[model samples]
Target: MTAESALTPTPAANAAGLPLALDAVGGDHGAVPNVDGAVQAARAGVRVMLVGDRVKLHAELSKYPGAAGLPLEVVDAPDVIGMDEHASDVRGRKDASINVAARLVKDGQAAALISMGHSGATMAASLLILGRLPGIDRPAILTHIPAKTGTVALLDAGANADVKATYLAQWARLASTYLKVVEARENPTVGLLSIGEEDHKGNAVTLEAHALLRQQAGINFYGNVEGGDLFKGTTDIVVTDGFTGNIVLKLAEGEARVLFGWIREALGSSARSKLGGLLVRGGLRTVAEKMDPGTYGASILLGVRGLSYIGHGSADARAVKNALLRAARAHQSRLIERLSTELSGPS
Candidate 1:
């Protein structure tokens, strides 16, 4: 496709009705969670095309007798990309599940691509197959963080480990647009993740990005935010390099697990504590549900010509189901078309 044509917004009527293409053989547990998730989503009326080894997929589907009545199709993808494989391997692994899934989106047979595979390979497939959106030099990954009041959008989560100031500025715009178009948050505020709240407190790159963001139109720049600010609900969106953002994401995940483990240990320490735990079990369950990463499902690879989402490598059936549902919702919302318009405007 020509550059101009690739940049043009795809009409919702043509792509919105397509089925979601899922990499059924690409997660930590292979087709188990993927098939279950596909069954769950299909049961909910979302059409899903599972791309992977046809035999394995069929065998898994057979485990769920009710799945036969659901809208689920399996496409043959005999190869599976390993988690340790480099993203470049996608070019050689012609029939890899993720590659096939991406191709389905590019060919208009799928509205979006969802994979719980090697995230690097998934991102590569999206970039190589679907191409980048207009005005986007490098696409970024966007993940939602549960905050004090609501969820916060964090971008460049792991897509670009090393980035230029311009990339950071662009990600802020992308994240803002995503929040507005998909999350229904109008004029969302942005925060530059840094060591301190002051504009001058960040490194040279952040300092430069801060100036550019200040001059950028349409977004509500909220200056700089510290690491703690993420859970404080300090801003609607947060922008950082993938290196730092990935570290922050990992740290947060680890901390949450440790904290919950401690809570469980403390609750079971004695009969008195056990009674207290039971009393607050309902409230704790609500909090836990909100804090669960699976609740958010997948991180969107924004700035792609087509919609792409990357879920956790260790994703469960619930997470996969949520990811498929989220992808369907995003396609129905005309997210890619809206994003094209957002990026095609003034820098």
Candidate 2:
């Protein structure tokens, strides 16, 4: 179809009321992984709309057996926006894959959109196309980080650089709802990122957020939590601005890498070390595999009118499949509509 039709912002809810739009063109590994994920999601009984080059997607579809006659449909667009293109530049490039995915949600063709492409473009396209749910100042990206204790929903991972105490409170609400829908938790503990657990700790913004989150009756605020508390899963949801959340996310990932390297070095140090490594290799591999970010697939861009998942640029087919499953789960759980109401309350 034409670019104007592709960019149209339709409501996400369908007549039957499913909530997911499987973005077939999103991902760093090109259309193979994306199409594979779509096929997998369709097999899993998820409703998906593929938005990308029809020729390439159909060719990929032919490679997979039993993928025929699925509920998936391809909306063709002649152009595609690249991952390197700045988010700001995507609006001018209407045929960008993310834009087409967002349009599916916007025009009532799908309930939500899932993408593994550039996060900036996803957020920008969602905002520019689907617009924000009422009362949400900005759309926040939520990552379901697999922590030491359990998974925690970290918000504003890269949506808004600047934030406010009120926004933090809103994040708490949105994240609480997210955990509830995804993890089936009624009251997930909400933690404000801080230097210490004390009330007086942290910078001006965090301190203010601490007070606001505490006062937010809608959220299950658990008071201040330090950066170290992240992997400990001290809280079910961690609320912070994009700046801090992104940095913390990267650091956590980096530390995981460093530890893996150290283990490798230590395991091969000598014969004695090799023997010791053999003893613990299974357990170590289990932890390493579980802790890998690729295992989680992609992060969800929450607080928008629809589902917009941002996958890692380096994501492989497995990661793509995981993201599609996430999109399906989010749609089944009515995550976006639920989050909108939780964040905005009654009109």
In order, what lDDT does every prediction score?
0.87, 0.76
Worst 10 residues of 2 by lDDT: 2-11
lDDT of 1: 0.87
Tens digit of per-residue lDDT, candidate 2, span 262-318: 989989999999999999999998788767776777888877787778888777766
- Number of clashing pairs per prediction, in order: 0, 4
lDDT of 2: 0.76
Winner by TM-score: 1
Segments in model 2 whose C-alpha atoms lie over 4 Å from true places: 1-20, 275-279, 344-347
For 256-321, candidate 1 gives per-residue lDDT tens digits of: 888988998999999999999999999988877777888767889998999999999899998898
Q: What TM-score quantifies how close candidate 2 is to the native fold? A: 0.89
TM-scores of the candidates are 0.94, 0.89
